[model samples]
Target chain A: MTTNFSRFEGTEDYIVSEDLRNSVNVAVALSKPLLLKGEPGTGKTLLAQSIAKALGLQLIIWNIKSTTKAQDGLYVYDTVQRLYDTQFGNKDVSDIKQYIKLGKLGEAFTSEQQVVLLIDEIDKADLEFPNDLLWELDVMNFHIPETSETITAKNRPIVIITSNAEKELPDPFLRRCIFHYISFPEADMMEQIIKVHYPDLENTLLNEALKAFYWIRSQHNLHKKPSTSELLDWVQALSAGGISPDHIYQELPFLGTLLKKNQDFDTILRRVHNRGTGENQQTGTRIFRNW
Target chain B: MFINFFYLLKREGVPVSITEWMTLMEALSKGMAASSLTSFYYLARAILVKSETNFDKYDLAFSKYFQGIETPAQISDQVLNWLENSLPPLDMNIDLEERLKYQLENLDLNELKKTFEERLKEQKAEHHGGSKWVGTGGTSPFGHSGYHPGGIRVGGASLRRSAVKVAGERKYYEFRGDETLGVRQFEVALRKLRQFTTRLEGPKDLLDLDTTISETCNNAGKLKLVWTRPSKNSVKVILLMDSGGSMGPYYRLCNQLFTAVNKTTQFKSMEIYYFHNCVYDQLYLTPTCRQSESIKTEEFLRTHNSDHKLIFVGDATMAPSELTEVNGIIDWGMTNDEPGLTWLERLAHHFPHNVWLNPVAETYWESSSSYTIQLIKKVFPMFELTVDGLEQAVKKLKVRQ
Candidate 1:
């Protein structure tokens, strides 16, 4: 438990808040599975990759789906394959060990060095799925009754679980992990994140884009409010389009890149249209007076 | 002591279990807090709080226990009051005849849709009191105020709604578990009904290892793999909710419960129907209880088997005649041939495993003036709609009565 582990200060590509950095470090230090909950595009899954890259460890990602079971992450016994081979091939059919395939968790446990095991979108699985993995996670080992074998962790691979919070995770499973909520980055932090993505971008364009981006996010009725990833993509589009700062707020050149949903698109467009007309009238009167 | 902080979190409605507390202690022992109060706050939160929904409560408890710690700055109540009270000035200029002529000319839906988009692209700035651009107080086919014949309102007064003020408050009272039954809590409670039963005759999707092994051995070492359908939660639900009229007070609670049930993936199938005051001959598909959108109670009972768990959500407080007398339903449009009590009895007898959840408190049940509640209670097991009551009801639903 007192082993000296490398602290995660966040990778150069990823910008993390102090609180989140502390949470990650504590989870790593205590060798507990860190449970990250956040909005869809807040880099919950990417954090695991960042940690893996920062620590120079192998990354094992287990993407969970609705049909995914806890046992699928441990080991799978291909009995059907073995049976098919018995009739079709000349291989040793009696050896059940040949049929056992190591899953993502099993690979991480058996790895030569400590690896980053990322269980991505764990809430996509059944309600009992997390509960089923509780014993394996706590003991850092799982039993294979078919082969009469117990696979124990070689180095207790650092576990990082990310959930979209689609379903409430069982309390017992939650108790065994270190939890952190990755809040949407504030303007200052978001600026840093945008800077990381576009280092040579114009300051005026960045400021205007951030202003418009944050304003769009402020609207609560959006079915899917633009997040960090969308902001980055929108900035890339803006920088590529070579749109001026003045026209950015006026026309909002690439509104499609920010708002994804049709309803959101319509809502923002209508608001922007109304805002634009007001500005046009003021500018029109100013020109008329000057003339 | 930091232990006090744990108790304070519990008091603040964060369900910080002892296991999580011990984990925090272990982290602290490892010097994970780094001897900084801010660091400790983050470290303790990571260990003790599992969900972001509880983070606001944890923050409240943390600031309360650690007092004087720099909690997030909150917006003043005066500012919030000012924001709430300050309504946008309404435009008084109304040219009714001109508006009617414009509307009549632009009545074509296709033309309106095309013009709206065209106007949006052409408009450059917010034009208040304009007739062409998409701005406030415009007679154009777009904008908010100064109505046109077929104008598409861009935004309303609610456009000023801000999430910053909400975050500044940090109350998150809606997410607090102790305050009321949230949809999440209801979903958790309803999840207990997921008792999976694998049918032997269904589509084979899962590998039946035990059967395969025994069969292979019986076939003299020849490998025989068997597949069977995976065990699934076979619980079916029929949710009959009493809507409108007296049930208006508990609309939010009933809606939350309905949303929870609708969200829960455990049940094999679910059917929801609405009624007003009491169940009569017909049940409406919608909460409005319209005569056109209804199904006969006899047809419903005949179609749905007794296997489905019947759940009735209503206050169950109505006029005694509404429950006992014929044609006593509160809906003026239609009359019931049989009393509500007879229908309740029929439903109860059909579905042996049934429960009624009353939004009204249990104490109010005995001293209540309404005889309908007592009469309904005799037909079906009645439970309060509280969290504890829901858990007990779920447990009761599992058992065959």
Candidate 2:
């Protein structure tokens, strides 16, 4: 079973480069889960939705929490509720199917139509979580002990997993998937991405904003660099605030949008202020400021 | 034919399992990656190489197996052009090899920097396969793609690992310490440090259905659901990590441990602080904080209770005087009446359960001449920064009086 998937055209907002499109196509054709790893806010999660939309597949998302278990992804047996009703409440205990709920992964597997199973932030879950899905993901079937029946996918789901590399996934689990690293967009790519969100923003303003964005990102001592999503947010805020290219220095207060961490903001602001005042003592620092 | 490739990868420490091997074979058989060597390379890597840490190792193993397979060295076109250009004839006979070798071995960093500048100005042409010019091959003290005992590599690939200084903008990423660890390894290792107990909260935590069903059956059909949340690891941990300078090499491992511990809600409270080579009179909350914003070491100790666990992450490769003598700090200028040993002992005493995590291998510490490592071992039980080492350290920290 293979997906006759092609590159998402620019008609849709999913403007992906040829390399990424090919990676997705290969993953889809191979029926292997596509695992996306990148910096935060670089659209790791958004890529799943774009792929699903482009391929015309139903999307089933499982946003993982720290306490999320792999069992929760398969099926959760509400034995506590069932027992409670069996003891106190006069409820129908005839059917065990009512007590057993199919989780996001379970739902995707049981669905007759092809679906996209997005296991977002797999790194957020406990380390063993990914390994638990290994057998089911590879074989496309899982057994429910209570029901004494097996649930298998009628059409193999296109699984898309995203990780921030917060914690390393097991090698066994990673081996079962297709991997791609979504690097921060370069100049031309960033322009297209920004235009997707803010279409009417003037060319000069956008150019100046990108220049500042890249300049601040180039700072070696920054705690966390601003990602592509932050760039869009910054440009949107600038456009709404009627900021011009020449007056960008005055809009330094809006830098909080770009630099999320307090230390990063403070460091950048301090350096900029020092450089403006000609108080930078080091020649290396002065050269960086100029660049 | 490609089974040998799998063995080579396994030997290179790539942990390629049989299933992944079969998958690669299947991929090739299906013409999924049979188009070209590059396609096959990507398909095999995507199927077999699991983590980013093993990518370089895979490249090396692949090159070894395929014989002439190159992973595209990062040397620039400009540098390549410069290196390809033949230099005008210069003095061919210069017997400065022994003297240069001695200087490379004995010269201090300050003298090395001086020599680098002098050589940069003296060498005018791009000399290839020569003994003097900073180009590829031969025995030059500079340039890439060549052989020299200790020369500054300009922009070429590393030949002998003797370059004192690399003259270019190289992208440095944090080293991933837990890259090879299995899933749930850290969490399982951290289970040894679970010292807190919890009361039953609700069914939201984790439903005790077996107990609930048994109790209900005994009570003549009265529903009693048992629920409980694992008490958060209530142990207070004051992690004092050394940052900057020598700490740069161990940054990724330190960061991995920090992130892993921070994400777990097992701790009652966790406080992290950064210091330079040695924990002097104070420590900064963040790396970017100035000295004025730092917390006094005395005050910090007083604030955290005596029971707080102190895990110091550092290489512990510093001058002996930094720990034993007053005002021995090499980076900052300050007059300290008390030595670093005194501060460390004071901390160890305040926190009875304390462990020092050294990124440097234990064998290196045993052979090192630095007395700081010796004093640290005497003051606190030291562990390597590896996963097993951390597990052992956690086990030691859990030991009660």
Candidate 3:
């Protein structure tokens, strides 16, 4: 089963760590679903798109909600539509296959070329949703009782399942997939990620912003710590506002871009205020004002 | 091919099944690891370890197995050099090689490597410790420690191994669930509270297929469709939390649980109330337990039905009189005609589905001397405030009276 498939080295937009890259390649090579878990905004969903881009495969995303059922991903029998057709007396309603619409998973399986099928935030669905999809995922096929038809994959789509760790996925479902937890990037990796978003960001400003950003994240009392996406937005805001490097750490311009919750904002503000007071005592200059 | 490592991982508490092992083997055969040790570490982990919670254990097991292989070979060379040059003439009289051999045979290489790595990270300077850290003049595991079997002498010329360094990092320790629970984890656990009920009454949105088919047949060649509302989680929860004083330590934990319960959209309704030490005549709406935010317990019970799952979060550690005697409420201004125990019993009786989650450890409960905890346990099923305990409590809540 050693097929000559090009390995996913991450797309230009996404900067993947060595371990993550290896996990992706291994999952691809073995033709198993890659389960990506991480803190929110660590690019679990983006990785699937990156893989699709890198491998030149079409991307199929199944965004799961609380009401999402496993069967919905495969196919939906539009019985109401069939009944409407029968009542209106327009077209022949005898063909059951006509009303059977292919869903995201079904489309991915039926695609002429291989695709990247992203089951984004699988945990958003009900607890049993993953268990329901186990058979289809393992065999790359599903059976429709209405049509008495088995929809098998023309090409087994590379499956990428992302989880927010909201629900603990069943063990049997987990056993069938390759799992990787994307750790939040360190300062150096964050720099690369920042550069990916803002290519021409000034080095001094970037350094000062990153320093303050990391310092805020390190605070234990924060209810919701700012993540990578927030940092990108903050940097974008910084450059657009033409905020100077010296004022970046002192003023913390557009801090609302980073910390979302009022509690987190207050926590950071208090700490920064205390530090700024101490610095003022030493330097005899008001470095910060209460936001 | 690293079969022992599989058992090692299992022994280290990572649940590595045969199916996952087979997948890893297949990957290896396909050159997925690319003949690199680091890649193999990652590839094996990605395949065998399904959760980040087990990643730390996997690292330990991987390092133990691989480092064990490399340790003895390197140790022998170091031992030989130390035996020749480092040993004093007077000490040589005690058959040094024989002693060294015996010590080497008994020493756990895995333990030694782990201790060495820990010592290397922790030890800032020379200090006295008993065979644990890197220091002299004691039975320290590293750096010319006097008379220790598994001592790795520091300042000796040794080759730096990349694999050991990778394992030493222990990056995934933060993800371990043994510590305080994240809100997401609490939400996951709380999701079990969802008792979905498909009400016949209300807005008809979903298509009732079976009814539609039967109706179509009755209509005689005419098509008909049946619409009905989908099943929704109808479980209502009433949370009574013990706030202030002793609960100060568990403030963050309670907050997380509260956040999780608030975040979970599964429940039909959720009502939260706060109390100090134990519930008396009134329950406060806020954690501060102020008079302004108070609600009469009798009124609360009368309004809410017995179908609500009543959850009590408390340490349940207080003076026996507080639960037993009349006017035993902790607050200075407040006065209760009845004891705290009676109030608890009344609430428990009112809501058939009731559970008490003690922030204190379960082990402590068994040996607890607190009369209040024992008294409360009789009224409501007491469980520790942990992931497992919360899950069990949720299960207990779902069961019919």
Runs of candidate 2 with Cα error greater than 4 angstroms are A1-11, A87-90, A196-202, A238-256, A266-291, B1-17, B34-42, B52-188, B199-220, B226-231, B242-252, B273-307, B314-351, B364-372
* Rank order (by lDDT, best first): 3, 1, 2
Question: Model 2, range A104-185, lDDT digits (tens) per residue?
Answer: 9899998989998999999988777898899999999999999988999999999989999877788778778887766678
The 0-to-1 C-alpha lDDT of every candidate, in the order given, reads: 0.79, 0.74, 0.80
Q: What digit string (tens of lDDT, one per residue) describes model 1 on residues B147-254? A: 555444444331222111222235434455544567768887898887788963568878898998899899888878788898888999999998757787787888
Q: What i-RMS does each candidate reach, in Å?
A: 12.1, 7.0, 7.1
The DockQ-based CAPRI class assigned to model 2 is incorrect
State candidate 2's TM-score. 0.73
Residue pairs clashing, model 3: B131-B139
Q: Model 3 chain A, poorest ten-residue lDDT window?
A: A282-291
Per-residue lDDT of model 3, residues B87-150, tens digit only? 2111222565476557667887667777666555555544543445444434444544244555
Model 1, residue B312: distance off in Å is 1.3
**Candidates' DockQ values?**
0.24, 0.23, 0.37
What TM-score goes with each of the models?
A: 0.74, 0.73, 0.79
User: Which sequence of candidate numbers ranks them by DockQ, best first?
Assistant: 3, 1, 2
lDDT per residue as tens, model 3, A1-291: 245533777878999988899888888878899999989999999998898898898999999999899889999999778878978889899999999999999999889999999999998887679999999999999989999999999998999999998777888999999999998898989999999988999999999999999988887767788899999999999999999999988878899999999977876777788786774322322223111
- Relative to the unseen true structure, what is the C-alpha lDDT of residue A102 in candidate 3, on a scale of 0 to 100? 93
